[model samples]
Target: MGGSKTSLAFLVLLLIGLLSGTSSDAHSLSYNFTINPRPRPGQPWCEVQGEVDQKVFVSCDCDRAEIKYLSPLGEEVKSMNAWETQTGTLRDIGDLLKEHVSDVTPERHMVTDPLTLQARMTCRCEDDRHISGSWQFGLNGQMSLHFDSENGHWRVDHPGGRWMKEKWENDRAVTEFLKKVSMGDCPAWLQDFMVCWEKMLKTSDAHSLCYNFTIDPQPRPGEPWCVVQGQVDENVFLSYDCGGAKIQSTSPLGEEVKATHTWEIQTETLRDIGDFLKGQLSDVILEKHTARGPLTLQARMTCQCGENGHINGSWQFGLNGQMCLLFDSENGRWSVGHSGWSHMKEKWENDRAVTDFLQRVSMGDCRAWCKNFMVRWEEMLKSTASPTSGPPAVQPTATAIGFTIGIAVGVAAGFGIIILGWIIYKMR
Candidate 1:
């Protein structure tokens, strides 16, 4: 009995180790991965049609995710209270950060010094305590350290030491310093360096936001679409919604382009852009859709054209202000002259950063296109706002009777073959 108990305790310890190891797999608050939660067992996605139009909402809010901005070392943290939030993920970090910053009560406004806005950073540290360090700017730009020294180890009690260093500038210095000081071995020079680094962060007004969330994307297989939350600019949030947003097709293409979701973002209409495109290229047809919303979600269709409107390219459209297509267009022969939009027009002639998305459709593999057009359509409108002007298409699905007829035809063909063989043998 004692031996069994010992074995049980050992097994418990082993399980505890496993669980502790997996703790690193946690998301910033959310993560990105493919999911196919709709299909029935053993059934390929080909069996389902409506799955292509389905939308799956991704939760970017993580309970553990954090958004860190210019808590410049020496300078007071703009959102000091936010440094303690440990829940929420990428899904809602933008909103969370916004809320955190907005919630901080503002003091009397004063004409402040010129602070750099180089970057708005978001990071998920192994220990949230590591994200910040101790130091503050005293009156007249005086700097003071708020760390405690004990047993030859230096530790910051107020969570304000590490933030003083630039995230990447001379990262080697911090790395070398941290290699020694990371484990509570902070020295005087390291503390001063931290203060200078934090100053750089507080002064910069513009820069790329960095994310270092510990993440494990729990991707569901066969999940058609995925959503990702990120920012291209400091305050501008970007969303790539791939939930069942499908690419449309015209006659000759037969849905050659995979139906995919357009990246949803705050941007303009595509028809106005299409007009711009039409001004540049002759004979342009822009198919557009306006989803119901206050913003009037818009989509403008641009088909890939070969000789005589033979479509060789296709793309998925999103309610957001972006479009991407892989087309073998004769129109590409002309130099795209839009001073601001030439890069997009010239994109995908040969795939670089955006060709890895392969979506399976009834037609074939649809490569994901990432060219964004910032042009607005003539206007955002609703279907109910306008009367129906075109005849609806009528498609009749073939029934099981068609299969019966095929079977009957095959039986007749077999009988005829047998009879012909017998006749040939008898004649010989």
Candidate 2:
């Protein structure tokens, strides 16, 4: 009777252990398993587990089965008789160990909770800062963990970002940003200028934190422009330069004729902000002087931004004040606003010199027209563009009329595709 009672008690305890999932056959154990690049600063928290095509790391609690991973990398998995690969469709780098462990078949052991949801654990072993594992491409689509040596650190690496997606789980639009000290992964002088330029838009420390890109001149140093760029493994550019119309030729008679454009428009964004400005070139001509002692130009422009965005009612105020020309992206067309002088109107109607100037200006430089434009408009800073010669004789020189004529050139260039500077002028 005593022997039978003892046997019955042992069986009941075994059943309890199995149901609780803590069953241990003398030497088996579980550990905390996590996957990696670890999330970015502001990204959503992602528990490292069940990642596809990622490097695997192994560890275990000190008291648990003395955790041992094949060192020197890719050796083999040593088998433990107590544990067998659980039959299932899921597999990861950990399962790849079955190849080395004796008697273990390709059957994979996927870490799951009682509810079957992937549950993470604390797998830490004394002496094992981290251990890497191996995996074959044949084992894709299912969970995979690999223990490998990269740069000397045992890390959980992934071919794609968390959970197998190519992008960040956190959908923040701020990836590329600018720095005034001109020190960072991106530089206005090299890569995307809009990113750096917009970085200034979000920051209020231009006097101390901005680069004055000097491909051309922009008022007192955009007092210092610089581009220090780096490539992000995933994101693309968000614009950072300008384009202008190039005079292809002069007519035999000296009239402004046959010109080629030297401008290119490019934008990169995965999310669409309703009123984003793609680009803008403004021509502010001071008409009848207002008695307010304040100067106001009959500011007209061919703003290239988004739909549902109003200009001036004035210049489009970058989306929510961000530094960019927002416009409707249908044809990526330019919006024309001519409010005065017929000559300027004529230019607004048809010219490429101005077109090139405006395009570049919106990207972040006003030097496409006259280097003097930005220098004269200190209210604005930061610049870039190649040096350009003044327009033909028909183009007015340094006076208000000349300025109007210059804008007229940009306008007339427009009727062509119609195309696209900010210049302040006082009527003579």
Candidate 3:
């Protein structure tokens, strides 16, 4: 009887440990809106999609101007103090944007065929206590202009953005409004949203990790450094400098991983990959560039381990910010993005050894690494502080607002597999 009671006490303590160890994950509040004066048969004139941490919570379209809650969490959002005001404001912004689009230019606002404007605004608060905000505007699905709200600067991306920048940059009202909204109002709204989403935003048991390596062909004199950044979910945990041969921990989770044997193996693996990639860059630059001032090569490997023990892995290669190749680890197939690089695809596909190695690393090795790190991740969370119990007394929400825009599709480059016999041949 006494032994059973002791066992029960142990179980109780374990449950308490689990609950106390709970830490909040990164959260984001964002909205995507599109303005199309002339809509297709099924399309809406003005459309809006709102998300909290990647989950679509609410959406509105021409069929219904009223916002519709798509998730249970979104339903709770109606109880927020400023919910009605905020929703109404969003509608007002949509109408204002439509008017603004009409006044731009004949090329943009032609009576017969008007160019659609895509806009997005986002406020993100990370577990590390970092906050980020963005507002982007695009035309005909191409990103044209971006606003840096903190500095109130408008950066022109495409030629179409030049006129918009010229019009808005000198306009103090426009700059201040963007600055006030993103730096002030967006964070305020996020704070309110966080209160209702505390339980929903808790760190999940499932684990995800990604490593992105960007290598420049002709890095400027002071910037010859090739680095690998590793992210566990949305937080950057570790970064390795290839030139300096140094590894720096960016978070508590990273510090813990640094002491393990796994870290040692990972460092060596990264170095080998970097060296292998460096050898191929010159040939690629020669082939792709007739006259190139600046160019970069990037490789990304990602893996996710679900609560159900299912694992998914992917490998992506890019040049100058354009996706060139994608590896479907599940099917062990290489997808070439451009026809110009079909030579690379044929070479890699024919080289059975190299193809198999990439599949093994992405599908097998990456999954193993993620599973091991997940244990460490859970342990680290136990020492972290819990999220604030409640949001502070609401600040006066600002009329300033901006959007977070997704990248526009571009010409995808092609990828060539690395020949790393000396480095990876031993893995077999």
Candidate 4:
């Protein structure tokens, strides 16, 4: 079911603030369901929202039996093999709450007059590596009852909840079901979602592309003489074997782009750049490591176009994959990340031709390429069943009954475990 505090709405706001400041390592998943026993003009009898890592991802307009995905991640979830089962679970939970509406509301407020019920279930992996889960139920935005996995007991938050608490606490089956769901099912689902999320990050481009070029002054017979790897949103799309003068596509997008005129131009240009880098590295090795031996050089180019139409670009130079110099493509300024590279930075900063070339390539060619590739990729995906986007959905408030601690921090941090008994869905 769901959980909340004195004022469920207010508690939701407070928890949002706390969650925002939480350490990056912490992750959470939650679902909130709202039910209207007596519907008015256009209000639905039940509605559900599913959130992952604090962002609303999926929602169902139960009145119409329609589901809307709020983000690309949501689309990925919808495409999962278990998606139908997941949605079915949502529908069942909503229906169950509607059927048992009176059991969760106070006797005085159980009249036929219009009344609203809100419940939330959540599970989280905290900064300290502790896993917690909770369930909260509220009527008309006021929290009534909650259950914490740690305590394995139901507590009445409002006097109105006394009747429901007494009824649920005595039922051993209900208690065990809540406990198993919050502690077992929820955490398992969260971990599985995180794995899918990590995979998504590597395969999809949210907004950016990066290319890394590595050149070796002395390569073994079995090694690549020089190579360039292209990545879109951290996903390697293509690789160029500089020594063999071959370009290998690593992804569908990359394979499609290979047929474009720009691909040939890009391959030739990268080969030229690789030669230029090898020359520069030879000079640097002579100056910095005459007695130390051969050194590899690396160049990384990155460009991104944001929602506001701003194109940000940067170029980085390093030795053996250790970053040393950074070039701001917008201003044509060169800087060194490490003091040892200060000499190289000073030499390059004084060359007007080098600065102009770097600036021109980043702002002109790089920006154009990034925008072109992204548009093509988007159009290509849109034509298929790839991740789709939808309008933003409102966030849901979370409430929970915590073990050991009574109110304030404990209750605010607690989240419920969601389980729809009829639907035995396994997260893939």
Tell me, by TM-score, which candidate is best. 3
Candidates' TM-scores? 0.17, 0.15, 0.47, 0.43
Per-residue lDDT tens digits for candidate 3, residues 305-409, read 766888777776655433356676777777654344566666666778766766777678778888887777875643332333332222223312111110111
lDDT for residue 84 in candidate 3, whole number 0-100: 49
Per-model lDDT: 0.23, 0.21, 0.61, 0.61
**Better candidate by TM-score, 3 or 4:** 3
Per-residue accuracy of model 1 over 18-64 as CA lDDT, tens digit each? 43432211001111111111223541111000000011111111222
Residue pairs in collision within model 4: 2-119, 2-120, 2-136, 3-136, 3-399, 4-399, 122-416, 134-415, 134-416, 135-416
Model 4's TM-score against the true structure: 0.43
> Where in model 2 is the C-alpha error above 4 Å?
1-222, 225-332, 335-428
List the candidate 3 regions with Cα displacement exceeding 4 Å. Answer: 1-204, 336-347, 379-428
TM-score-superior candidate, 2 or 3: 3
lDDT of 3 at 189: 75
Candidate achieving higher lDDT, 1 or 2: 1
Worst 10 residues of 3 by lDDT: 406-415
RMSD of 4: 27.4
Q: Rank the candidates by TM-score, best first.
A: 3, 4, 1, 2
- TM-score of model number 1: 0.17
Q: Model 4, range 1-428, lDDT digits (tens) per residue?
A: 13323344455566666555443244567777778766545646776666664345676646555576655677876665444445655666677668767776566354444456666777764433346667777654444587866566677755657776777778786666566555655665565566567554332223556777877766646767677877664345787767665588877879877877666667766776677777678656754454553446768777766656777677877654344577878767676544567788887788787777667666777677777777667765333322123211211111122212224444445541112211223321
